[model samples]
Target: MDISAPSLRAVFTAVKTEFNAGRSTYTPTYTRIATVVPSTTSSEDYAWLGEFSRLREWIGDRHINKMALHSYSIKNKKFEATEGIPSEYIEDDTFGVLMAKFQDMGYAAATHPDELTYACLASGWNTLCYDGQNFFDTEHDVGEGENEKLVSNMQDGALAPWYLLDTRRPLKPLIFQKRKDYQLSAKTDAGNSDHVFMADEYLYGVDARVNAGFGFWQQAFGSKAELTEANFNSAIEKMMGLKSDKGRPLGINPDLLVVGPTNRSKAKALIEAMQKEGGASNTNYQAVEVMVVPWLD
Candidate 1:
């Protein structure tokens, strides 16, 4: 029941240390090349395949370090070069070539659906057009012939770009509460194709550990209830929650709560109340376990 200021601080210190130490490594690779090619189309339809080969080599050279860092297994030998160029050679066709190169190199490339969505989310790109023709109007216009195909591909229901980025930056600390709207803010930029963007519309009410702990206490002790009697029941319920019980109505109270200098006195008062009730009562209820972990600063 009683949550000592020092105890709460210690818990916070542990959490902070864990956060700093926790690291995530995400290695994304594009899908297989054969998967992207339309079976019905003749090989002649893609004459620009050579460009794709060159692109693959370029990407492998540039991203080798990143791939190594993430432990990707792709090697140049895996790339299966075609005998001759296909004939169609449309600008949109290049995407397929890019996909193949990515696969051969073992870089996780987005699925067709994800690819278009990602492009639109990045700066200098748009999935919609006034003419209802092209979905990806890059800062530089893609030729008219391929524009319609790109637009059509996008309308077919591509995944959002942020999804791909999430796969890449799985461990990035996110600011969840401020991102509750579908309309993305201009201030938030995806620094690289691999950087993940926390969706503005999905971040509402989400909090890191500190705020979450505060919320737990507010619900348990801030209610209009008797101090000596109610505090004892609340503390018991709070502990049960931490033990994995639902602790419904009150929800799971945090195992620990941290108090800064500003609120240290208030926290001490609450701890005293719990200590008294726990000592007097015959129940298992006791002082809330609080650990005081100080910030380095």
Candidate 2:
């Protein structure tokens, strides 16, 4: 194999091709539970998150919509994965494995959003949201003054957590904020790149600026209790009965149930089975789409 500039560039191109192909072949699951919000800055503010208003008759002056200036924010985060192949391997034509690894790198980058989104959700019991409370707390404040009340989106217990989401709205229960999409880059110039000169290896990497946060907490319910018919029904009822600050129904309908692998069988029986184990018709069969992800406990 030639060790010239053209040859090195060609190798980079080949690795990038494998990477792009791997990216295309990977399927992502985050979009079903989160909304993608393209970001233009290092961070974004959601202070205006709770300003949704209801229309009133215009007999008097017209009502105006307003946004709070600095209520909540999510800062974009940097992430990277790097791999290298020794010059000896490329020169000796033994870089086949490195090519496969590059393809896998692409697959990993594509799957990163799912990892982040679900991990953020799994940690929602502690992470604060626009309301200055945990995203899945049992006491999110609603309304104001005498009308103010404490509302809960979480059912607490010592069991594995499951989630119910109303994803039909314009904004899903989770937010995926991306400032830049993952991209492949290389330090392949053997003579020019300091890394190559020092290590005698060509480097390749994928990097992105992205982060995940909670969206409208009203659109999601998290329960750590045993997953049962009674509990599932309670979650559904709770979500459907949620309202906005002004006491208007938010029309939350739980259309997705997300569970970890530990709850796979129960989730299947709750939503995917046509009949119960005892021969009774399963009234909750297919009540919502179930996603048994491996990310949560």
Candidate 3:
């Protein structure tokens, strides 16, 4: 059978399909529950889920219940309240006039344009990067001593492979909360706790979750390596030839090469070199796309 090279879109689609499959199969600690029980205080306890399937051979209880801390800082080790920040006050001197005008014109702009914009796109970056997945399986989650290998590696200022998914496995390498909702005034302050006048204000809160689970995935330490054609090819080979927890060939066919800005040019050159017909470094000739992740830099 004659076969030409796959299109870039085809290759990317294949990679994304594998990614989605990995996500779909992911067994979060609370996958059995219809609604996650909010931990009044954060704790790593998913024991209520009972015995895990063979699919969860790599995951553990420690990977569950990662709290979505809107008012705390895990990295800085401090309480970072979302409210109490100074907001610019704009007195609508025309409120009375605006209402009268609305009655006549049938339209009145109550909120500012910038305010609406920020409200809509506040979590743009996180949503894009994580594919709209929540970090936690529980509600309003926060915790101490909960260890995530990815977050810990980042905290230690190290570069590690955050994930290596094997679709054949019964368990997914990653599990996201899949939460996507927001309330304009989810947080009620002292003045607005029980009942309040218009003067009492409320703060918006995101129905966000925390990310957990690292044992299900693989971690590679390669940030210290120099960016070169040899290194790039070697990394790909390493990924493709990975072994599972059971020590069998994982058969991981990596199709995307993600890099930081510092190595963008080098990555581009490597991609081009591999795509060039009859090129010395094009032995494998696997079509892998390159993506420069700005946040990685």
**Leading candidate by lDDT:** 2
State the weakest 10-residue window (summed lDDT) of model 3.
Answer: 72-81
lDDT of 3 at 170: 37
The candidate that wins on TM-score is 2
Model 3, range 1-297, lDDT digits (tens) per residue?
Answer: 111123323322333343334334422322211122233333333322211233335564644533332221111011111221111111222222222322221111111111222221222212211212222111111123442111211111133222112333333332222222111122334334442134343232222223222112222213325655565565556556544323455555555554557777766766656554455566534456664544344
lDDT of 2 by residue, 69-169 (tens): 44788899999999998999889877777788888999999899999999999999999988889999988988867899999999999999999999987
TM-score of 3: 0.39
User: TM-score for all predictions?
Assistant: 0.17, 0.96, 0.39
lDDT of 2: 0.90
Question: Which parts of model 1 have CA positions greater than 4 angstroms off?
Answer: 1-229, 238-253, 258-266, 269-286, 289-297
Displacement of the residue 62 alpha carbon in candidate 3, Å: 31
What lDDT tens digits, residue by residue, belong to model 1 across residues 144-257? 343322111111122221110111111111111111111111121223312223332101011111100000111111111222334435444533332111112223333332
Candidate-wise lDDT, in order: 0.23, 0.90, 0.31
